[model samples]
Target: MAWMSLLVAGLLEVVWAFSMKQSAGFTRLGPTVVTLVAMLASVALLAWSMRVLPLGTAYTVWTGIGAVGAFAVGVIVLGEPLNPGRVVAAGLIVAGLVLMKLSSAG
Candidate 1:
């Protein structure tokens, strides 16, 4: 359950990050509001997950998920570059996250 919450929080983090791009320095009312709301929800869920999950583990997983998710969204939805280096780096992040999860299970 805590892991699930962390995943949701991470997803929300991605949403808020993308929304921030559209915020136009907070000049755009709709995107700004959406960003704020998503950010708040992300934080809330992260905090809740921390109650049951170790802080270090939860934070690492949440951040890893957010980073990967945001990068994918940028590449797919925004037509951002998906250079070989970027792809390799993302794969490394996923590998690291998997390793962390496996270690933590012990």
Candidate 2:
């Protein structure tokens, strides 16, 4: 349950980040509101997950998830450059997150 919450929080973090871009420095009202709400929800879920998960592990995984997700969004939806280095970096982040999850299981 905690893990699920953390994962959701991470995904929300991605959404919040994209919405922030769409918000155009908060000049756009709707996306700005969505960004703020998603940010709060993500943090709330992170706090809920931290009740059981180790702080370092939880925080790292959360940010890793957000980073990779945001990168993918930037490439796919935003039509940003898709370079090998960026892809490899994102893959490495996922690998690290997987290692962390596996280690946490024990």
Candidate 3:
């Protein structure tokens, strides 16, 4: 349950981040609202998951998911650059996330 919450939270984090970019520095009303709502939900779920997950593990995984997810969204939806270096960096983050989950999701 906690892991599920954390995963959702992480995904929400990505949603909020992308929405924030769409918000245009909070000038856009619709995206701004989405960003705020997703942000709150993401944090709430993170806190809930923390009740069962180790702090380091939960936080690391949360940020890792958000980071890699955001990168993919940027490249795919936003048409951001897709270079080898960026791909490797994102892959490393995913590897770290998997390792962290293996070691701490016990």
Candidate 4:
């Protein structure tokens, strides 16, 4: 399913983003490789999903999922700051994503 592919692509986006941070500006070897691999897969799946989904919907949802997922990982794993404002922003992104999915014909 295109939507399923998009979801997986979004998750892969999170993986790549975290790994990219771990890569330390490509100074590290292992994390750099992981980042590159995940990035490729994420883009590939996103492109696949785009075959069926609207471009705006697919791109927006992909970025939204990645943004929220990376935010969670940053807070939980990296111990980044988690304030009320950031929480509300992430919630709003989720709200928009929900509305986008609901409005989609697919």
Off by over 4 Å in 4: none
Error of 2 at 15 (Å): 0.4
lDDT per residue (tens digit) for residues 2-81 in model 4:
99999999999999999999999999999999999999999999999999999999999999999999999999999999
In candidate 3, stretches whose alpha carbon ends up further than 4 angstroms from where it belongs are: none
Per-residue lDDT of candidate 1, residues 1-106 (tens digit): 8888988999999999899988989999999999999999999999999898888888898899999999999999989999999999999999998887777741
Local accuracy of candidate 2 as per-residue lDDT tens digits, 1-106: 9999999999999999999999999999999999999999999999999999999889999999999999999999999999999999999999999999999952
lDDT of 3 by residue, 1-106 (tens): 9999999999999999999999999999999999999999999999999999999999999999999999999999999999999999999999999999999953
Rank the models by lDDT, top first. 3, 4, 2, 1
Distance from true location, Cα of 75 in model 1, Å = 0.5
lDDT of 2 at 84: 96
Model 2, 57: alpha-carbon shift in Å? 0.9
Superposition TM-score, candidate 1 onto the true structure: 0.94
Please identify which of the two predictions, 1 or 2, would achieve the higher TM-score against the true structure: 2
Error of 1 at 90 (Å): 0.6
Worst 10 residues of 1 by lDDT: 97-106
Better of 1 and 4 by lDDT: 4
